[model samples]
Target chain A: MTRPVTSTDVARRAGVSQSAVSRAFSQGASIAPETRRKVLEAAAELNYRPNRIPAIMLSGRSRMVGVVVGGLSNPFYASTLECLATSLRAAGLQILLVHVDDALTLDSALDQLLSYRVDAVVTALAIGSQRAARMLSDLAIPVICFNSRLTGPWISTVVSNNHAAGLTAAQVFESCGVTRPAWLAGPVRNAASRARGHGFIAGVRANSARWPDGVLEMRGDDSYESGYDAIRRLLARGERPDGLFSSNDLMACGAMDALRQHGSLNCPDNVVMMGYDNIPQAGWHAYGLTSFDQQVDCLVDAATQLLDAALGPDGGPVSRTRVVDARLVTRRSTARLI
Target chain B: MTRPVTSTDVARRAGVSQSAVSRAFSQGASIAPETRRKVLEAAAELNYRPNRIPAIMLSGRSRMVGVVVGGLSNPFYASTLECLATSLRAAGLQILLVHVDDALTLDSALDQLLSYRVDAVVTALAIGSQRAARMLSDLAIPVICFNSRLTGPWISTVVSNNHAAGLTAAQVFESCGVTRPAWLAGPVRNAASRARGHGFIAGVRANSARWPDGVLEMRGDDSYESGYDAIRRLLARGERPDGLFSSNDLMACGAMDALRQHGSLNCPDNVVMMGYDNIPQAGWHAYGLTSFDQQVDCLVDAATQLLDAALGPDGGPVSRTRVVDARLVTRRSTARLI
Candidate 1:
């Protein structure tokens, strides 16, 4: 059997350097039109398709990753996605982004991504089923869950320290001498929210007998309107909660808008509000919302390391769940009372 | 030479149905662990690997597309990206997403995407230079320029009726009988911004002899802060334009917030404000912003059709530019003076 044509063969036929032939095939590379045309002609004659990534290269480095993410509406996820894409590209890997509209379809999304033979799969969407986790392991695919982590160590995960965030919010309110505090919660089913809420209750219980009852709880669907309506309902109860700890920043902003519009509350003065996910908008002069920064870079870094180890030789696919620390940003929303 | 092993061979060897064999390789596909392990063992015995797609298959039916987008911070692009991903999946194609932080790096971004051998590319970032356009066409790859059309027919494009959108805003102000209409423009270098601004000026010229001088124009970076600061600067001049048309919804929201906080101007009654890109916040009761809906689904459909034709057998890789109409959404932000 005859040997297959290669870039070097095409280079010889085109009478150009091997690098020039590679450059002609590369999208952003700048080779003269004449040289590129000659390379293309030579490649066509030799049936030398540049796109065919070799299997040896594929097993070692397909240079592609699948990232399934939901929560595009949240700036935090959007920003985090950008950071991951940049970081992945810096390491010569391209990203395939699959936005899971619903959690039910997450399995299928992963399936589709796997068909692409990606080097790794990172999901920002919550996937909790053991069966799904096992399937991924069966395929020996490297998997990393971002932001929200699962109960099992079947998949390596890197998440923000949501428990600490909740604790910080409770402490902020207690230190400000707030008599009544409310938890403006995000999607209750969300693990991140559950962690934050759990920590908040624990911290509050530690400080005052006001424990559970003192914690007025209201739910928001991570939308501005949800938070706005929730705050309006709480305020209509005659007296407003002296302190508010929102599960996410958007909800906190909406709550703040509601307070200023209806209760004429100018945070920290009339009410103190602490939010999770210190999105850039929270820093706006109008909001000045005190919140927590998830430290996306650190999370991305952890996930990157996990991926490297999983794909490395002698890899047992060591399982791990790493929780990076989060920092509380004190802004006007939760200013301490004088 | 022997025939290559196929899924049917794997299925026959494992005593499983063809569909089951396929499912084992697919994501989101459900199969019993015992059955899956059996199929895998059989495949290992046969040395069968379904993931190694040949170069011919890679170039022809890999069914993957690359989408490089910027301005995820802008909800419009974020929403557009989601729509494209869903539509592409419906057509059995996967998406490779690249977040271009700066327009300057777009060349390299496109290069990396091409290395994946995507069937096509969709870029929302403006491509102004002739060289960039030539490079894409030189690859003999199909490209769909989303949201903004370039100067040449080398690439297919779909854009919103930005100029008409400008005209609609101009007419809205005139119908409201505003004496001084101000334009809150986005980045001057952005083609979309230029199209909208040019259309607005022309629209005003058609309605009144006072033409140019009767209108006010201020620049914004299409951010909430830019709009807020621009409005504040206009207010500090001790003058208020009766009509305001912001290039984007975020900027428009910012402008409205600034007006209410500093200028004490009630929208529609004292000053009517119109925004482009009808983001979800525009419909919220707090803003009730009147804006233009770019009809993202329609745009996606147009680009999809273009891709189909370019890849079709009878298709000449035809290159055409299509602009769809955008409808005005009238809300409280632009109430008629009564």
Candidate 2:
């Protein structure tokens, strides 16, 4: 076996002090250009990978970030986690992914996170109740939620304007000359779901007729079937809504299936469906569901910024809300151009 | 601010040597019951966390496992990762998740994994391409792939019995008296896809003209649209198959959508559609796609065992293959009640 190269080996080969070798690798550490070049050459020849010990001793920077995420079953969360992981890697920090199952609460997950003493935690919409946010706050840990608003005095939240996003979807339908609208809502208890439902109602009222008394509101897990069931129940009620708005794309996809099953749901026809969080599946030719493209890049940027701020010199600002904008992505599902 | 506790404080409070305090925390380290109790009491009072320093010193045994997963878009991989993360956590190991994007080759991801020097590397199914298996042979790092099979001396792979799984699906169809069967296959490049296809064909032949002229095969990415397109194309062909077998639940779902679109596919009379990979969507009432369960628990166990073998005292056997059995799950998509 080849001998493992050490700092001493590099110093002896470079004919410089060990401190000079260390300075060449350390960020912002000053060393003469010639000396740095010599150290680099020696280190390269011996294949010396710098042990993380010096970095730990000098600055206590492990350069490793912890990302705790749940609900991988949902494509929206899965995509967000992918983007977040990629962004963190590009920033030269390794991601320690903690996938908490449905049975495990956010508190128990945080216990594991605390054990690692992660530099920061990016909780991408953890499962269960809102109480987890308070637990995260009490830990005095920096947490940045994705699309989940944290109403506390110490944590930062990164989210899209769900209410405005929903309103925008409805307005698009209204501009397209649709008055009767149905909401294929997620669990109505969820904050984002309620906000969007409220906004959609507001948008519809501003246009015409206040959607009458037959504004079908469906509730289920944010799934395609829930959307489908919502539409089915509405159709059974003998109220053919001209416009359908789903809070998320999964439900919208389900609604699309329901439309297909009912037959002849097309442009200027039976009904038009739109959804939020323009998930990747929305682009498929099968669905091509019109939806809102939540500003994923901006959401991720906000999360990264929050993590950075928590590690900043001023002891970090807490209890801040960052909202990224969303735009309507028209598709065949809603029969909206562009 | 509260003063941070150190080992010296624990030793002073416990009235024992610093080494005794260290032994109290270290697993299998010799320490008397009385002294250990005293050290624990002192640690609790001082709020001192142990093993962080020595764990740093032995960073070589950091117990952090790196997982390079491809296809976050697929829910199966997501579930597998969720299980692996939970299992690893339970076993006192940290997970370093590296999401390898579509464009990045497995070799590049493996290189990145090498840089981290993880105790082990776990790759999801998509990563066991021929080129990647060859790279694994040379890397000398502990690698275990889930639901992926790569034939090589140094590599370890855990896969469900695709051939038998396919045969089981066919037999189930045969029992339902379905003669004309069509196969909605996944991409030709994927090993699991091909294996399942081969097994189904074998079963058809074994049944002796139960499915005469073999099952029609359509190839595309393992997605809903692909399944839809495959079935649509198959329907347009000369022989309209009475039964459809989608290689995955997503594609089966698409096939179901397409079948329903044509308004000819019914449970007993027209067609019976079955899919592989019992993804969560398959269970929903909308699709209820009949599919084969991958026996994820068994798959995870094989993966965990392989990882242990690869990193254990013996440094793994020269060559090993672990194949987990699978079961067929009957559902509404193939509502034939076989």
In terms of DockQ, which candidate is strongest?
A: 1
Q: Give the range of the ten consecutive residues with the poorest summed lDDT in model 2 chain A.
A: A102-111
* Model 1 lDDT tens row, A119-195: 77876666656666666665565788765454344368887888888888888887888888889877755778888
Going through the candidates in order, their DockQ values are 0.41, 0.34
Per-residue lDDT tens digits of candidate 1, residues B1-338? 24657788999999999778878876578999988998888886775657645533535556678888777777777777778888888776778887788632255565555446677787666665666776666556678886554534447888889999999888888878777889999886678878898898888878776455757989998888999999999999987788998889999888887888874777878998899889877876667899999888898899888888876774544578888899899998777663
Docking class of 1: acceptable
Against the native chain B, what TM-score does each candidate's chain B reach?
Answer: 0.84, 0.86
Residue B143 displacement in candidate 2 (angstroms): 1.6
Ten contiguous residues minimizing lDDT sum, candidate 2 chain B: B102-111
Q: Which clashing pairs does model 1 show?
A: A111-B27
Model 2 interface RMSD over true interface Cα atoms? 3.2
DockQ of 2: 0.34
lDDT of 2 by residue, A1-338 (tens): 34567888999999999999888776578899999999988876775656665465456556777788776777877778788988888776788887776422344575566456456677666324556666566545567775554446457777778889878877777666666777877774466777888888777777656455535666767867677787777777777778888888888877776777777565335577788888867776557778888867778888888777776775443767788888788787666532
